[model samples]
Target: MIPSFRLFPDSASTVSGEVNGFFICMLILCSLMAIGIAALIIYSCLRYHRAHERAIGDQRRYNVPLEVTWTVVPFVLFVGMFVWGARMYFDIERPPDNAISMYVVGKQWMWKIQHPEGQREINTLHIPIGQPVKLTMTSEDVIHSFFVPAFRTKQDVLPGRYTTTWFEASKAGKYHLFCAEYCGTKHSGMIGWIYAMPRKDYQTWLTQGAAEGSMASMGEKYFHQFGCANCHHFNNQGRCPDLRNLYMRPVQISTGETIIADDNYLRESIYDPNAKIVYGFHANIMPNFTGVIQPEQVAEIIAYIKALGPQPGAQEPSNPGTAPSTYGAQKGLAGPGATSISGSEVQER
Candidate 1:
């Protein structure tokens, strides 16, 4: 049975416990301070009442020790509080290395979430009860906040940048979520619910949600919709790598060294493609889809690559023989990563 108001959600991860403890401590300290201040105010009013007031000489004067003590004590308390809060903040922001990642886009009226497993939701988040879920979120237009009060986690999602928030729900239940910030006219309607379910139930939800147009399928749809095929197709005249199976594949460099095309590499290739030039591709031709594709879509694209079953030999570029010619040496077009790649020779393999 669930209680009416829970101070803390079920503890599933290490940081939640610390967060709960810190929250409780804060509540206790605040309560004590409020009570003490109230009591002192009442006592001063009664003792120093005008009817019973003494002469001017009998009143207290400035005390250097008292002044210093008041200032120093508060300073120390604030510093300690800051340090304690910072520790918890850092731990919560930086999730474990193996934490499962999810992408959330805070829009004007709703929260769009894309699970790593291809499940998508609108204003409803479904997370595994005991798994550490790291949410990489950004706002589409204005500043927004992703908040889950029960889990004691909230993160600002700003446009043109990325921010992350993470938490692990201990017990399986439905919890309320809100956009703690006053965003706009529909801010009140931006409320949502987080469904924390058992691991098996979460898996079942993923499978059920992915029955149609899964992440990979949506990615493929977007890839085609965005006209990526015009320049990325093997038989086409484009100067970019084929989009068949780019993720997790060894990208051969000019120096003959092969580096795995991992997530960072792929992300760089998307927003700032020329950062690391593949052997045969021209960076300038690849447009930065940062503004075009939402962060959620980027995650979907990555998910599609992960689901592509194995990179087949047919997915390899057909223009491998033209590797020596750095197509990126000259500016091809005004695209996101192309500006950097132009006139830059391929340095590493």
Candidate 2:
């Protein structure tokens, strides 16, 4: 059966209606202002034109009330618009605490998606309605944009770094997904569909697939497979720094600089170990795995690292000298043949 065409896409997300309303308000205001200016121009031309082609025109200064009205009214409207837009921008940028996390890897002309439950999809995404879904996306090649017109959400996926965006489906239906950026020759073909289903149906869909395991579980396997377990151990007895409770915490480098152990930091540490050395660790101890592993493997390893720690908001040690209670006072342990750094100097702050 043939489907009927519509001028605008369906509003299938929680924020789509708000976004549409704001857009329409702006459009109507601009259109009215344009029409008013055009009408004034036409009226002036007809009412005050030269009577005989040699008629002299009268010089007049602008009225204070008219000038003030135009200036103040636009300034107020513009400030209002700025405030409204900024509020919406922040609301969209910050995902809720309970959002379901999903990973997306964009490369060439296709999108690779992995759910937290380990189900993988290519060019197609299935999300549950009424629940917020947050996507942590990165590109394996050139830049690509993850855009969904119906949800009114778009974010650029860049190489070597992670970009995130979230949206909650309001309606259970299929929505169009597009790579808004001009990627390569097959950019036009880089299109997909988002299926928003009921929570029960979505859970059934997840169970239908033959899953390897959760993303974190898969990452743990990769962590061991890549020989990372040899040097970096969870028990703090390893020659290298401890991996326990390290995610999202500040790490001091050798150069006396502090940086967060975010996804990008983990990726860089794997691909290029020498880029940013941890404050206590020396370089050349960890081998560079630039061409050895794919981006998906790196993501999995990061997931495993994330799993080792308390997810984001756990209470950190108040005392700088005190180590995290997870591994219990072993924060500064350096076994035999370990590169030297005093355990006391590795501050959790």
- How many clashes in each candidate? 2, 2
lDDT of 2 by residue, 1-349 (tens): 6688777779998889888889999999999999999999999999988799688887786799999998999999999999989988876777765688789999999999999888899999999999999898999899999999999999999998899899999999998999999999999999999999999999999999888998888888887798998999655666677876566556767886565677788888999999998766678999999989788888788888777766533444432212335233443442322223223233221
Best by lDDT: 2
Candidate 2 residue 203 C-alpha distance from true site, Å: 0.4
Candidate 2 TM-score over all chains jointly: 0.86
C-alpha TM-scores of all predictions:
0.67, 0.86
Q: Write down the lDDT of every candidate, Cα atoms only.
A: 0.69, 0.81
Highest TM-score against the true fold, candidate: 2
